[model samples]
Target: MNAISPVAHPAPSDEIDLIALVQSLWRQRLLIGLVTLLTGVLAAAYAFIVTPEYQVQSVLRPALIKDLDGLNRTGVYKLTPAQAMQRVGAALDSYERRLEFFRANQGLFEALREPGRSLEQTFESFNRDAFKMLQPDPKKTDNLSAFVGIQLTYPADINGVALVNGLVEFALASERERIAADLATLVKNRLHHLDLQIAAARASYDASKEAKIAALLEADSLKRAKLQDELKALRQQLRTRRDNRVAQLDEAIRIAKSLGIGKPTTPSALGEGERASQGSVIRTEVNNQQIPLYFMGSEALEAERNALLQRRSDDFTEPRIAEIAKELQLLAQNRQVEVLNKRENEDLFLKDLATWREEAARLRNLQFEVAGLKLVSVDQVAVDPLKPIKPKRALILALGLVLGGMLGVFIALLRNMARRIPKTANSAY
Candidate 1:
C-alpha cells in the first residue's frame, strides 16, 4: 500500500463550535449568575449612596428696544441690542467678577468646600466644574437671537436655584454699573476736550481781532500821511502861484508907469476904439497866446499883493484841504477796532460751539440709573429641579448587567480552554 497518508478530516464548522460554547457557558451558569449578581449589588449600592447633583440654568437674552431706550437716547453710548447681550455675557464670563461675587456671598458657597483645600481653591474648583456657560451655536441657522445662560450643578442640599439666579443678577448689575461709569468718564473727557477747544477758539479769535485792529490802524496812519503830503503840496503850489502873481503885478505897475498908461487897459481896448472910429467893420485879432497879467492897474495889483502877504492860511484856497482834515479826524479812532476790543463773549462766534455744547449737554443729562436701565432680559429664571441629574440608577443597573454577563462568559471560556489543553497534552504523550 502507498505510505498511509493521514485521512483528511474537516475542521468543525462555526455552528458546531458556537453550540459547544453555549453548552460550556450553560455548565458554568451558577458561577456566571453569582458574578453577575455581585456586580449588580455593587452598582445598586453606588447608585443609591452617591450624592445627587441638581442642575439649574438661568437664561438671558438681549434686552428689548424700549428697555434700552434710555441708554440709546443718551447718544453717548450707542449700544445695540446685540452689543448689550454681549456685555452681559462678558460680565458673566469674567472670573474676577465671579470671584468678587464669591467673596461677597461666602455663605452661599460654604457647602461646596472640600477637605484639604483652601477657601479660594475650593471656590476655584466649584467655579470650574460646577458652573457652565451655555451659548447658542454660531454655525446653526436657527440661532438668530443672541442668548446666554449660566448652568450650575450642585448637591441636593444646596439652593441651586437661588444661587444661579443671584449670579445672573450680579452679572447684570455689574455690567450696568460698568457701562454707566464708562459713559461718565467718556462724557467728562469730552467736556474737557470741548473746554480746551473753546478756549483755543477764543484765543484765536482775539488774536485775529487784534491783528485786524493793528492793520486798520497802520492803514489809517499811512492814509493820513498821504493826505497830509497832498495838502502840503497843494499849499506850496498856491503860495508859489500867489508869489508869481505878486511879482507880475510889480512888473506890470512899472511898465504902466513908464508907458504913461494906467487903470486896466488892454491892447485890444486901445486899438478897438480907434478902429471903430474909422468905420471899416472894426476887425479885432484873435490868438492862442494868453493875456499878460500886468494889464491891471498898479493900485489894484498892490492891494491884491498886500492881501496875499497878510493871508495866514491857504487852506481856504484849496478845496482838498477840508477833505484831508476830515479824514485825519476819522483816523483818530477806528470804530471796528473799538467794537472788537469791547466784546465780552467771543465763544459765541466759534464755528463748532453749538455742536460741542449739544453733545456735552446730552452726556451730562444722560440717565445713569442702573436700576431702571435694563441691560438684559431674563428669558428663564432658575427654578428648583424636580429630579437630580446625576447617578442614573436605571442606566447603571442595565450597564452592570451587560458588563457582568460579558465578564462571566470570558471567565468560563478561559477555564474550558485550560482544561482542554491539559487533556490534549496527556493524549499526545
Candidate 2:
C-alpha cells in the first residue's frame, strides 16, 4: 500500500480573521468618511431649515394683602392669597377656558393652522404640546413660596410673548368675574332674607297691637257693666228709704189726729210750765231728751206725706247715681283702643325695624370694584426668547456623525464578508 500524505485543510468560513477585517476596513475608510460627511451636511441643513420653537413663560405668586382689600372688605366672600393663587392656577389649567379663549380670538391662532388640517385638530395638537402649567415641585428644597406659571412652546415666527400674556390676563379676568358674580348672588340672597325678617317683624307688631286693642275694648265693656250695676243698686236703696219714710209719716198723722192736735206742738213747750213750778233744786246730771213725732199736728204730717208720695225721681237723692252716670259716659268709648286702631303704619313701632332696614340698605349699597381688585401678582411676565429652544445644531451634528460612522462600518463589514465567500467556495472545489 502506498503511504497516504496528510491533506492540508482550509480554514473554516465561520471563523473570523481579525487582520483581514482590519485590512478591509482600512481600504474602505474613504467610503465611511464620505457617508459621515453626507450625514453631517444633512443634519446641518435640517438644523438651519427647520422651523424653530421658542418657550415663553409667565410666573404668578400670591397677591398682596392690600391688593385684595376691596374684595375682603365686602365680608360676604373672604379669600386668602394662597387661595387666590390656586383659583388663578385652576382657571389657567381649565381646558374649557382655553377653548373659550381660542374661539374668542381666532386671529391669534391663525399661524398654528397647517394645510390639510382642520382648525380643531390644529388646536388639539397645540393645546396638547404647546401649553404647559408649571408649579414648584414639592420635593425640591428651594421651593419656599407658593407659585404658579404658564409655559408655552411656540414657533419663533409667532408672537409667543403676546399669546402667553394674553392668556394670563384672560384667566385672571375670568376668575375675577366669577368671584364678583358669586358675591353678588350671595348679597342678593342676604338682602332677600333680611326683607323676610322685616316682614315677619311687622306682622308680629300688628298682631300685638290688635291684641292690645281687644284687651282695651274688653276692659271698657267690663267697666261699663260695673257702673250700671252700681247705679241700679243705688236707685233701689233710695226708693226703699222713701217708702219707709212715707209709712212713718202716715202713722204719725193718725196719732196726732187721735190726740186732737190740729197744729204743730213741741214737748219743750209743755215741759216749760212744769219746770217753772218745780224750781230751786239744780240737777248736775244730763240725759238724752226724746221727742215724739205725733207732737207735730196732723195737718203738718199729712202735708209732708203728700210731698213724699208725689216724688217721681229718686236720682237726686243719691249723689253716687250722678257719679256713676258720669263714669259710664266716660267709659263708653275707649280712646286708647280707638287711637291704636286708627294707626296707619304700625311697622314704625315694630321692634328691630330700624336695625333690619339699615342692614338691608348696607347690603344694597355695598361696593365691590372687582376690576381694580388683584387676585394674583405677576412675578414674571412673558418675554421674547433670545434663542429657539428646539433645533440644537451642535447636538444634532454630533449624533449624526456617530450614527453615520456606525452605518458605514456595518456596510463595509457586509461587503468584505461577501467578497470572501467566493474565495472560500473556489478553494473547496
Candidate 3:
C-alpha cells in the first residue's frame, strides 16, 4: 500500500469525512464566527439605520353618477358596461393629466421659481408619491368594498390628509367633465334623429295637404264653369226664339241654382270652391272650361296635426305666419322649427360631433385651469410629519435572519463535501 499524501488525495468522496471537517472547521471556527457575527450585526444595523419610509395613504374612490345621457336615469345602459367603464376611465385619465397642470404649467412654474428654491425644487419638496400602504393588515379592511387600497401617498414630513382631500376635489372635477362630454354626445345624436323624423313627417303632411286641396278646388271650379256655360248658351239662343227661349233660361237657371247659388239676377259666379280664384271659368264655343285646385284639410284635422308638430295654425294658414314674420321678413316664413332641426340632422349631421367637441373643449379648459395643482387640505390641518406609519420592522429583521442562516447552512454543507477522500492506493498522494 502506498502512503497517502494529504494534498495529493484522490477525488474526495469514498472516505467518511466527518472528523476532518470538524478539525478543519475548528481551525477556522474563529474566522467563521467573526464573519457570521459581523454579517448579523450588519443586518441588524441595516434594519436600524436605512431610512425608514412610512407611507401615508389617500384613497381614490371612483365616482358614481347619473348616466352620461342624463336621460337614462335607470342604470340599464344602452352602451355596454365595458364601454361605459372605458369611456369613464378615459376621462379619469384626463383628470390625472391635470396633476401636472398646476405645477408643471410654464406660467405657474415661472411664478414659483425663486433664486434659491426653483419651481423644480419646490415641486420636489411639496409633492410626493401618493401611496405606500401597509400590507392588508386585515384590520384595515371594511366590508363595503372589495378594494383594499389607499391611492394617495406622501412623505412622512408632507401634509397627508390635506393632500388627500385636494386630490379628491380634483378627481370630482375630472369626473364632471367626463360625464358632461359623454352625455352631450348621446343627447345631441338623439335630438338630431328625432329632428329628422319630425321634418320628414312635416314635409309629407304638407305635400299631401296641398295635393288634396288642389283636387277639391279643381272639381269645384269645373262644376261652377259648366253651369255658367249652360246659362250663357241658353241665353244667346233665347234672343232668337221667344217662348222656347224662356223655357231654356229657366232650365239654365235651375242648373246654376243646383250648385248652391241663385240664378244670375245679379250675375255673380257660383261659390263652388275653397277659394274664389279656384272657381274661375272661361266660356268656350262648345262649353265652359275650369281648372281644378288643391284641397284643404278640415279645420279640426289641420289643427290637431299642427299641435303635434309644434306648428301654429297661423304659421301655415293665412294669419299668424304673416304677423310674426315681420321681424324676420327675409327668411322663409314657411320653414318650421322641425324643418330647421331636420336640416341640421340632414345637411350638417354634426349635432353629436359638435356636442361632444364642445364638451371636450370645455373639459380641456378645465384640465388646463387645474394644472400645476397642489393638493391642500379641505378642512383640516396636516398632522405632524414625525408620526411615521408602522414599518413592520420586526418582520423585516426576521426575514433577513432566516435568509442569512440559509446561506450559512449551505456553506457548511460545501465544507463537509471538501473533506471526503478515496480508499484505493491509486487515489493516494
Top-scoring candidate (TM-score): 1
Decide which is better by lDDT, 1 or 2.
2
Clashing pairs in 1: none
lDDT of predicted model 2: 0.87
Off by over 4 Å in 3: 1-16, 23-28, 53-165, 180-217, 236-392, 399-429
Q: Candidate 3's residue-wise lDDT over 1-429, tens digit each?
A: 999875754454555567776677676565566656666676777767754445444333222333233323422224433344343334333434434544544442343345787655565543444333222355655523312223443434444555544444545455445555655565556556656755666576556656755655566556556645654555444433444434444444444445433322212223334455557767433325432111111232334334534532222333433443442342323344434435434423433545544544443333222232222212222343464454445765666666656566556657655543233444554
lDDT digits (tens) for residues 106-149 of candidate 1: 88987877789887898888889888999998777463556988
RMSD of each: 5.5, 4.6, 22.7
Candidate 2: segments with Cα more than 4 A from true spot: 1-15, 115-121, 138-143, 233-323, 341-347, 360-368
Better structure of 2 and 3 per lDDT = 2
Candidate 3, residue 82: the lDDT equals: 31
Q: Is candidate 1 or candidate 2 better by TM-score?
A: 1
Reference-based lDDT, each prediction:
0.81, 0.87, 0.44
- 146-210 in candidate 2: lDDT tens per residue? 79999999987678898899999999999989998999999999999988998888788878888
Rank the models by lDDT, top first: 2, 1, 3
What TM-score goes with each of the models? 0.84, 0.79, 0.40
